[model samples]
Target: MWFFSIAGVGVIGVLIGGVCLMAQRKSLFGVLLSMEVFTLGVYVVIFSMVWFLSGLNSICLVFLAFGVCEAALGLSVLVSLVRSTGSDYVGSLVLGHF
Candidate 1:
């Protein structure tokens, strides 16, 4: 029951994040934020599953490492984008692309 609830929330989070990503693809910050949310949902789902199953100890650690790497990469991309554009607006950045 708890597993299903957590998984459901994660699925919803992913859907919302996907929509945000598709709508704001031009903005680096928006993309990064959306990705973060999506990843967090994934982590939540996985964590719940692991907790319910009483799985391997290393699984959670591995997920944590992945999350850290993702955050670092996302932040780096956002910084580069901001440096180049001087604005965080997705629409403006996308308009400049062409």
Candidate 2:
């Protein structure tokens, strides 16, 4: 009942993120945001399952910490890329620039 509804929302989130990632008109930051959304979807599914199966635990905290670190690292890369290229368009990026 409620579980199915919640899971459906999580799945929808994942699908939306996937669509965003596949979009052609996206900037580098947009791609990173999409990836973050995908990660968030995964977190939602895992957190819901764990919470339902037992009680909330330290594992949830670890997952959150990882998500934060991933976002930070990704943004750092994006910043460097923008600084070097003066643009955030993925298509314009060249391997030699790095």
Candidate 3:
């Protein structure tokens, strides 16, 4: 559990730094991919919490389910956005389309 938490934090930090330097995630697809990586870190932390607390594994499972759903939703939105705008620009998602 502790290992997972530490690994999650470390990887997330690296990811953030890489993302900041790359500046290549100017599209919705790249944004969603980053979000999924972030979600994975969250899942690891949550799993560690549940493990130490002696709680039910259901909590971890539920979070995993949500992550899956988020990935699916992101992909669908990306596809639709591309179809409508002919591009997967991140700006479109933030321009009050919601």
Q: Which candidate is the best by TM-score?
A: 2
User: lDDT score of model 2?
Assistant: 0.85
How many clashing residue pairs appear in each of the predictions shown? Answer: 0, 0, 0
Q: Which of 1 and 2 is the better model by TM-score?
A: 2
The residue pairs that clash in candidate 3, if any, are none
TM-score of 1: 0.79
Point out where model 2 deviates above 4 Å. Answer: 24-26
lDDT of each: 0.80, 0.85, 0.74
lDDT of 2 by residue, 1-98 (tens): 67777777778889999999898474989989998898888788777888778876788889989999999999999999889989888878878976
Best by lDDT: 2
Regions more than 4 Å wrong, model 1: 89-98
By TM-score rank, best first, the candidates go: 2, 1, 3
lDDT of 1 by residue, 31-90 (tens): 888888888788787888888898876887898899899889878766776777777665
Point out the worst 10-residue segment of candidate 2 by lDDT.
Answer: 1-10
Instruction: Please say which candidate is ahead in TM-score: 1 or 3.
Output: 1
